[model samples]
Target: MGDFKVLRLVTQGELSWEVETRYQQCYQLTRKTCKKIKDRVTVFQAPGGFLFDIFEIAEVKHWPDTDVSEFTSITEYVDKTLSGYFFDQELKSALKEKADFFTFGVDVFDVNNDKCFSHVELVATYDTKLGKVSCWTGKSYPTEDQKRDFINCPSLETHCQRLNGIRVLVLGCHDLNMFSPRSRASIAPGTSKEIVINQMQKLCDQFKPQVVLQHPHATDSANIWNAGWAGVRKFLPEVKTYSSAIHYFNTFGGEPRQPLTTVLNRTATRDVQNIVFTCFEDGGIDLV
Candidate 1:
């Protein structure tokens, strides 16, 4: 049997004439229903609901804020939560039959230093409709001279062709380094946001991706969202963007114990009107 979770919106102080009465009535009905249903029901109340007298009769669980740091933990939590709501065998069969999953790895290196400068190690794509999976890899330079060398490379055109029409683009750290004014200062003297913009434009012209995902640990700078937005806008003016960073309070902040995958899966299943872009600080899975 599937478990049922209820979310009730609660407000403080004396109930308003009509709205408060309606909410109270709804709460009463829910409470009565749960009493009859017993074990299968899980009741949750928002913070301000303490004033409600229903506390005496109904065992209400307070909704707690959540924060998660590790990727593997989040995935495990998500899978477990999903099991409570969806049958494991049925969900797996459905996903296999309906979802198109793709994985890509990105890395940026300082060839001169023989070290990886920045990178986003994992990017996974989720689509229920598309059947083909494709990947394109390339190295970017920090200076105009290095960029010119890239332009001269014969493989550039071929890679672009493979990337063309891809609906999503996942960027690693250092991919948006030029967008950071501080980082740009360390590159060739004339390396400006314009140069970065032009480079992005070239990629956009060829690939025309609809969404961009940025991983939190992939970059060297503190402002991942700003740099990512600036870079992606050059190629896709209205492209949807998302990041995996845990800094944003609304998206990825709370009690550290909350599973990151639960939030991502919830977002993916929401009935939004536009294309959805899911990102993670370390790793994530999406069902698009």
Candidate 2:
């Protein structure tokens, strides 16, 4: 489920969550300033209905603010309080299916020190509560540069067997973009694939890790959707790619709310309707 954050609630006054569909349309159009939340969710009630607790996904603050503090109806409030749990349950199911086949691991390291790799270790050991990912190995590292590079990038050399490993070296936002200039902006045609290719090769040479993952930011990806994933494909042709792959718990301040594509892939086409309807019943944002 998306993370839910409590926005302003009517303390002295009573505001029902119920509102007309037209009012909902108005809210949707005006939530731009209020959408900068973590869970990145919006709440809306069914047409000609009421909401109980008004719940807004933490990300709604990213949207343009239009006096969301003002309460319109009571049902909207109820919808906020109750719908979050419902959407959370549904989102859990959806993310589980999305992450099932990715088989990813993390290894974090302190950028300043050679001792603790926080990101890599966290990814490798942290278990997904939704059961989408397998259990963590809880592996520890003694050295700053741990090597195991042949998993994603194949190596024919006898010393480098293709082991299933996720080794990573954290680079700052500036350094990553230095390798791929296109990565500095939105991924587009003729982006410098070589920059990333070179970086991967250099990392492989230095660490000899089975696979290497990078943490690219919107600045590195030009704030484009899935820019990192796209950069992976464009830059590293030798590695395997997964369609509809999503970042694991990475924070992107309020990217547009894309419908759960991974869930739609596993479930039937008709199920999409149910999923979407459930999204609303679960966490659709509407103004009273």
Candidate 3:
């Protein structure tokens, strides 16, 4: 909890099985990321679609790395990753038997401050209904025709976490974009746009977090899809909003977006920080 440095995995266009036959991707990727990361991640930020379609990796599961200065914690998934359409029975069965699953994620606020996982408090992101995209077919479909992809949120919430004595703001891709009416209709139909934006303001004003992380798979993730964090900047003018996204030209298909890694600063201008990683390289970035 002393150093504020963090290692980010941009998780380029290699979301699916790089092996092409066996889905041995996440662990291999994590191991490679571990090699380059020179900082411990008591609290981490996972880019959207890091492994599965969309998930938040708030804290690393294994800690007590041999050297905190060169944090080398790696991850492996072991649960049934996916059980829905777009996946056949054979593929699902193979994944459940051989692949690993993330077992350490809860909501950011649900973590126990009194408890520590190997001398480090664990912070997790509780997937809530606040800004969850519904039955995403990548396009609209009739309500009845749509299947129940997921349902029944324990609660609706937007939150930031306190980790290693640092106030960190974690925004899902749609969470920040909730300011738009169209986003409301798709992401959280029952809510209003103004309420969404105001909630972010409340968190920023109350916590005065120095760092922010937003992960998405969109092309313009560096600019937050062209709608920058302008609405909330006045309150958090000094905060550095960092972001990581899948590389442009991923299998999802998109044009090249440079400065693939960037941070949105006080004045709401993007401070282009192009950080790149090949399958063999190892390095890290400081949060300070």
lDDT against the true structure, per candidate, is 0.30, 0.26, 0.34
| Candidate 3 residue runs with Cα over 4 Å from true position | 17-23, 39-44, 53-158, 179-191, 224-226, 238-241, 245-247, 250-254, 257-288
Model 2 clash tally, residue pairs: 76
Clashing pairs in 3: 36-282, 36-283, 77-100, 77-101, 78-100, 78-101, 79-101, 106-125, 106-126, 107-126
Model 2 over residues 109-158: C-alpha lDDT tens digits? 22333332222221111112433322222111111133221011111121
> Would you estimate the TM-scores of all the predictions?
0.34, 0.25, 0.49
lDDT: which is higher, 1 or 2? Answer: 1
**Candidate 1's TM-score:** 0.34
lDDT of 3 by residue, 1-288 (tens): 134443344444433422221233444444444444443343333344443321222243322112222111211111223222223444333323322211111111112323421211111231112111111111011122112221111111223555445776655444445333344345444333344355556656777876655444434334544444543443466565444333333344564445443422221224322223332112222211
Compute the lDDT for candidate 2: 0.26
Superposing every Cα of model 3 onto the true structure, what RMSD results? 15.3
User: Listing every candidate in turn, what is its Cα RMSD in Å to the true structure after a full C-alpha superposition?
Assistant: 19.2, 18.8, 15.3
